[model samples]
Target: MEKIFDNTEAALALKSDSELERARFLFELIKRDTLVKIGAAVTKFALKFRLPVEGLIRSTVFDHFCGGITEDDCLPVIDRMFSKNVHAVLDYSVEGKEEEGQFDKAMFKILKTLEYARHNKAIPYIVFKPTGFGRFEIYEKLTAGKKLTQEEQVEWNRIKNRYDRVCGKAFEYDVPILIDGEESWMQDAADELAESMMFKYNKETAIVFNTLQLYRHDRLDYLKELHQQATEGRFKIGMKLVRGAYMEKERERAIRLGYQDPICKDKATTDALFNEVLIYMIKNLENMALFVGTHNEESTYLVLQIMQRCKIAENDKRIWFGQLFGMSDHISYNLANFGYNVAKYLPYGPVRDVMPFLFRRAEENTSVAGQTSRELYLIKNEMKRRKLVKSV
Candidate 1:
């Protein structure tokens, strides 16, 4: 396994004592009943900072969650990972837009990232959210089966052109781009757009990767349908699968609308679907390019077994493993050691908008079983090994 459980190494190398202690403290704080309150304080502090959080957010969260403040600036980390045989998917985490100018700026930033990736061997992929460049309500209406108004359609076309530019750059440079999934309400539209892009650019290679949230009960079926469509169309299908993130919102909306929830009934259902789809892809590797993005040990190993069973090489270009930048060192680092293609989804941006991303990670750690406990356990172990006594 090459000791993928080297979070202790990543942590000790990247975080100072105060930074590690703060992570440990936040680890403790997030577990208590006062989590929301602690979250509020963290948000307040993040807003008070400058570009990077220098000591607090940058040293801990940014160091853990992002490659760097800028795409080019991330070279050291990117080089380090590539030296370990891990690749990267660059994510610009600017969010909550309300202006056309902001949208243009976001597009410019992403295009710039794509241009930079053309020269960087380690950066094979880049990701962006539709919400970053299009209005959420506009997409919700389109995905809700509503006809778009003239202005909305025009706006949609422009936003889509921005996507085309991103994909076109990727196609030009022979790099791949992964379009992130959005809210359940807007995912259908995202999928349609991503599918269209894939058909356009992925006729030869898997360049456009659409995210599939298996937490949705229908996505496995959707993956099957998409695979069929891609085969019939003679195009390669690319996918990044995750246990969906917005469970509470999906459930609440379903109940409010009095519809059967589209999400899986439980985590087990989602996990089962994820592994099955992964196996299906591994078996049909040539027709599909797979990015197995998860932290669960079995799911990660399940993909490994699928590749092995299918006689797929460890360095197969069609399959890669991924986990979010901050959270899953053991998965990515270890998988890379096994000579499999693996990467961290490294998010970078200014502090304010990135706070939402940060907050979500914290809450997710609290929600996921043993996530915090394991992190706490690791930090304490490393600290004790260093003979440093910590408070609480």
Candidate 2:
């Protein structure tokens, strides 16, 4: 049967033979659980002590997953994807710095990204983490209903100012921006700020987007509530939907704190909820702009099926699909090839700075059952086909 993800040539169009070989080797390592565990530990130790393993990592997982170590370095990757009809969302992948100076630097970097995106028609969106501009402790306290100290009040104001500057620039450039979702504890603050920005900048169009993680049992309802608010408020809602990245951390935290887990009970529940939200947003497409960020083939097929049933155009500006830059090219390239609106989340940063993001990608592949193996199978199939074509 023909499948949405069956177009291997479209998927691997931009990959060199050497790149495919590297991916195959990396996925093979990721598929071995014992090796992954040992590798993760060794990587952590080496990075902690500032060992010279950067070259090994840069050539392996980093090359497979990230765009490059700098904005200029990402131009070729961006141009290559755009050549295939896929757009880009430039994501600054730095994480886990809390100093005020660090936050200021991040804000400057994001604004620079937006400025760069302004001239590049290939870049449709810019994204940043809220914690990149504010302290996690401040968000946690705010979410918990605790009053901020006098110093924190000033800090919060600065955070708000940074958000306004970013959103305002996005609006000025007529480019959309995504405020990524984080842990449940700090999500409330992010949501509140995102909604406020949407109200300000999304009055005419969805210039500011908020992310919703559907792995939480409560998020589907949260989506419905936001739709209702948008209806009443007479503004558009821009939403980026994902199955979430912090499931294990969320569950463990709930267990440790003796509270009800906020996550869906199982993967099936999360999957059902994700599809339900997708359908709901599609049905309400008039007032909603949806960005579906997922690697799941079933979810991608579900969206295609619903759009076909609803007679939505393949090139609708209000709807888009996204996958991480280095993964899920089958879905991205195939959809783009067929004239669907698709973009890759192209994360870029210094090698040392993006290590956390890189590590998470590796851990996710290893821990998620069948993920690495599936990637390996696709690469092998594509390689065989290419070899056959050459021989002929």
Report how far residue 70 has shifted in candidate 2, in Å: 1.2
- Evaluate model 1: give its lDDT: 0.78
Ten contiguous residues minimizing lDDT sum, candidate 2: 1-10
lDDT string for model 2 (154-250, tens) is 9999999999999999999999999999999999988999999998889888989999999999998888888888878888999999989888899
Q: Quote each prediction's TM-score.
A: 0.90, 0.98
**CA lDDT of every candidate:** 0.78, 0.91
Model 1 residue 95 lDDT score: 75
Name the runs in model 1 displaced over 4 angstroms.
1-23, 41-55, 384-392
In candidate 1, the residue pairs with backbone N, CA or C atoms under 3 Å apart (3 or more residues apart, or in different chains) clash, namely none
Task: Give the residue spans of candidate 2 off by over 4 A.
Answer: none
Q: Could you give candidate 1's per-residue lDDT for residues 293-381 as a string of tens digits? A: 78787888777766676677998888888888756555677677678888888888865667677676666666677766776787777
Which residue pairs in model 2 clash with each other? none
- Give the CA lDDT, 0 to 100, for residue 376 in model 2: 84
